[model samples]
Target: MELESYRYIAIDGPIGAGKTSLAKRLASLWDAQVVLEQPEENPFLADFYRNAGQHAFQTQVFFLLQRIRQLQAPLDPALLEGRFVADFMLEKDMLFAGLTLAGEELALYETLYLQLRPQARLPDLVIHLQAAPEILQARIAERGVAIEEGISLDYLQRLSECYSQFFYHYEGAPVLTVNTEHLDPAHNDADLRTLLQHIEEMRGKRAFLNQGG
Candidate 1:
């Protein structure tokens, strides 16, 4: 895929959108280091998912700090010169914070986010994977992550909308949006090849790969 030209590539999407899978595949193909969001390390995630009203603030804050620490170095060329593939963009941290926080909590989160945003480096390219919320829900159910068990189809729908809006206006870097309801790159060789071609074909500020049903 001629990935050497780009130092860092970000694979982004809502939960169950196959971002982590694709990011790992791309990194492996290029023999590059991969940085992934460590949701499993978030001590408040399960409780927050089960009872968002009670734990949302802590959950969001924990993720914000984690993202900063994980991304600060590799994202900057002077600190880390090696190529890397990241499953989540540092800015997307605000997307989740917006969804789970509001009023005073959201205001505070935004304050912290803005203060730290500059330290995070922009990726050379961003691959945005999207799918129908129903498809996303089914995938989540199949994966059976106990904490995510509490994630409703309604939430997935809302989250999908949020992602769409975010990417629609996002111009920080080149974005290649892919409809993944029918694409599985991690396990299917042909699908991965098709996706790689899409990446190579990407042009302009925005591009799309929609495998119609």
Candidate 2:
């Protein structure tokens, strides 16, 4: 399928995978409306990173509510010929909850997720970014978001694995898995063009982008 043919595109990946940057760039390039996670707005995020046991529930709940609000609105028909691009897909929130929460907390989170998830719509296309944990860690450190200072390599490794597993079985939308280990679409215009070209050239429901064209 061609890139512009997709009216809604969602980008998914583990933290530090550069999904947000790519989402923003694609939205801008296509003149599309962008829906992002807005992680900075989550008050419990920093605390959760520092003290996951004490703060995981609050952080996850905050994201669930906030993201549902963002996802509930139907794509604006009034907007010009453009797409809606979001940095996250709703179900992956469960991935984090599963990783961090357990027992009653997890059960409660699942219950709430089931209730709120009906509002979210699947995107026509999903761009799933992939990168080694070491690369992700380096990018995270270079970007130097203070709240991310607490991110651990081990956590990133686990998150990357979870992302890989999640997308492997994902059937909600056509997914394009792009390995970013050798591509810097976030910062390099050439690399971004390479990705966009691959996106447009895609001919299957599932394709992988490894080396640039």
Candidate 3:
């Protein structure tokens, strides 16, 4: 696929899947502007992790509102001039909202979400990062966020399954699902280069690049 045709390339995945780092690298390589999600901005994340049932709705709302606000800004001229690499896609927030929010909360969330849906810029390609739960757990541990210490493997597995189900039917843009279990884009130049090749050559609705496979 010609890189010229793509104005935005988004890297998406669950936590610890290296979306941020890879987004940075891809942006640097392609001279694309980077739009990264700021998780720290969500004050409810730590509490949500400790007691999901109690703080889930607040956490989800914070993220939803924050994302909408961020996207509400005019599209950066740099991003419009060149390709853009983003660590998060607005639609992916629904994956977490669906998993964590309950009946009344979810209904409220959906209403607000629909209202803000048009604010997001649709990407030309999305890189859906994937990894085994064990890999995800280890990476999260390595990050050493005190809040994530309470996150359970079962929760990560459920999140992974939810992502799989979402991308399975996603047809909005070309998607490249990569198994990033053993591939470290941070330290492995080979892995990064391989992904770059895919980003440069891919044109299909969906593709997979599993270095582990």
TM-score of each: 0.95, 0.92, 0.93
Q: What is the C-alpha local distance difference test score of each model?
A: 0.87, 0.86, 0.83
Q: Tell how far residue 114 is off in model 2, in angstroms.
A: 0.5
lDDT of 1 by residue, 1-213 (tens): 354566789999999999999988988888888998889899999998788889999998888889888887787767766779999998888888888888999999899888867556688899999999999999999999887888888889989999999999998888999999878887789989998887877767898888766
Report the C-alpha lDDT of model 2 over 1-213, residue by residue, as the tens digit: 777588899999988778889988988888888988899999999998888899999999999999888877744454424689899988898999999999999999999999877544578889999888998899899999999999998889999898888888888888889888888787899889988888788776788888743
Off by over 4 Å in 1: 1-3
**Hey, what RMSD does candidate 3 come out at?**
1.9
lDDT of 3: 0.83
When 1 and 2 are scored with lDDT, the better candidate is 1
Model 2's alpha-carbon lDDT is: 0.86
Among all candidates shown, the one with the greatest TM-score: 1
Candidate 1 has an lDDT of: 0.87
Q: Cα RMSD (Å) per model?
A: 1.5, 2.1, 1.9
